[model samples]
Target: MTYPPQHAYPASRTPGGRCPVAPSLYGPEPDGNALPAFYEELRREYGPVAPVTVAPGVSAWLVIGHREVLHLTREEADFSHDPRRWSLLREGRVLPESPIMPLVGWRPALLYADGQQHRRMRAAVSEAIARIDGHELRRSVCATAEELIASFAARGEADLVAHYAQKLPSQVIIRLLGLDERTGQQLIWAITGTVAANADSVNASRRMGGILSELVAEKRAHPGDDLTSTLLGHPARLTDEEVLHNLAVMFLAGNHTTVNWISATLRVLLSDPAFRSSLAGGHLTVDDALDLVLWRHPPTQHFPARYATRDLVLGGRPIRAGDMLLLGLAGANQDPAILPPDGAPVVGNRSHLAFGAGPHACPAQDPARLITRTAVDTLHHRLPDLRLSVPESQLTWLRSPWSKGLESLPVRFGPRR
Candidate 1:
């Protein structure tokens, strides 16, 4: 859901990552914790649909209404998921080396395709993910979560971001995709590079693509019941590139979203004394807490590149063919109509845009949530006294327009049992 970070490309490329064409503004650059307020301001001023520069010289519509998000997702015939349909990219307006390139650039994967192509690819991944047994998945998640917590629970303190929050999901995803532990660990760093849109992103992406291709080949020769093997055995007969790309997409998407949500939820639990006391003393449930996080700090504050397939009006604003559309998932969840002063409804309201909607909605959401919730419960149950090790202001967020992640989450806890 998150776009890659915006950093300078090579000097042969634009060091500033700007097109030098006086791009229209999105706002003051998004500093940690400033983005949500900026989104609020945009909604107040521009209503649901607002215009902002995506990258240098590239402007797009940001859809902030809950209904508008559903509308765009539901009205796929008018709005396309295909980045190839983006006129800017088609006309060479977006630079090949631009930081946003890897995020907005077209790949023959499920997230970027439409019509029958989308259906075919989606069916492959969907069926594969659906085959995962819920009970077994939870067991795997618990095993990983427990192992990680055990390693650090005995220590009075640990940076949960590094030792726990980040490790559990990556390892779970690795196990699901049949990646060996070592290779999975290595690839996690590569994904960090690519998601940050660092100058080395190209090399990182190449490394990821290569590793995934190897996994695809391994599954082909000796298929197992794992998701990778399940994909290999699907009826669509996807090419090596398609298989590798889709797998890579699943891995990265899983890591990016899960890591952010876990850390964000932990940040809230530790930083907000009143909210934590209520949840701790049974006045509020964990489901309520997770739901609030899903609404307020969705992993992707500004999702990338849902292009317009044809000229049309949305939220009473004129949107032309090929105009880039960014779904304001974080904003939509707080749309005035749906969210009031206190916040969103607690229990049983599944109306948030965190997992998106429509045909392209995240297929792995159930498993992803199960894994995250399990991880949370494991830590809380094991280390009931866990709390922050540093001041709240000192903890910085990942400074990426496309992402909402804590740079690190340091904490201390009672010694392990």
Candidate 2:
């Protein structure tokens, strides 16, 4: 999982120049969690378009400027979202020869596909998200948040990550998908393991895929009103395998990313006493907290890997076809060019790359935002004194290139009034 050193591009440097893009600021020494520092370094060295080699043969134009990244994202034809190319690079396989090729052989999930295929899948799922009544869902989320907060509130100690923040979104996603209680719990565990970016995560993804395959079969025989059943009823429209793929994708995409958001938001809120007071007073709404979370600590620290389908020019550099493009979302969000010149402190409502953009933008963003806002609002209102139990230095950030989140967050607070 280590990439070789490569140079990042500056607007003025030729590809064959002596100017070296800085070394990757992560990996073995830092255990791959040095993204924040890396971003800062790149910003200092290359300005808006610094070139850094993330891995061998994976030299990407790290678009740090907000407008630049947005422009690249909008140009789907120029920068493809195909995961196979990146998968090949990761496995060190030559073009079209990766063992995981079969996995990505078909057009990737809606997030990775292009043209009509991507549009059709997104359209199908859009209805489900649009049909969801956010107000009702928010009420349910608040009720769940209260119940969870109350459970540990009496104990005066809890791991916010494991017991509260992580659980809230899983439960919400389960309800949204209309899964049964037992199935929901299993899916939550499976999805969490799958997204953690470890051997366990890989195994969990496969197991979840198998389980989804079986569920697809069962749904076909006995259709219901659930999302799974809806996919089943559309047999001619979507094959069983495609349904399973989308469902598996949904589980991984929806569960972990949202969990990270919840944890990071809580971390930021608890770390700042003033912000906590503002939250307690209702001066800052859940929406406010969410905006702050995205700006301050995006769920995923790095952008998902992208590939160039052909030779193209970006940020004043020529990138060849099949070149791996690492769109540094975290880097883009923090770019000074996008934010106000005075550099206003991180707060909610700042436009960011947390959910990505363009044809492949996350479709579940609305529901995810609604769920997060509701959860935060509920917790603040129900447990005003909730605060961290452990010192900030003792906390451990999850070590993964895929998501930026904590391994745990212990908190204690007075019992609900």
Query: What lDDT, from 0 to 1, does candidate 1 have?
Result: 0.78
* Model 1: per-residue Cα lDDT over 25-137, one tens digit each: 33335654766777778766566777667655666777888888988887778888888887777787777887666667778899889889999999999999999999998
Task: Identify the runs in model 2 with alpha carbons over 4 angstroms from their true place.
Answer: 1-35, 47-61, 85-108, 234-236, 281-283, 346-350, 415-417
**For model 2, how does the per-residue alpha-carbon lDDT over 116-161 read when each residue is reduced to its tens digit?**
8878777766665676777888888888898888778777778988
Predicted structure with the largest lDDT when compared to the true one = 1
Q: In candidate 1, list every pair of residues with a backbone clash.
A: none
Per-model TM-score on C-alpha atoms: 0.90, 0.84
lDDT for model 2, on a 0 to 1 scale? 0.67
Per-residue error (Å), model 1, residue 307: 0.9
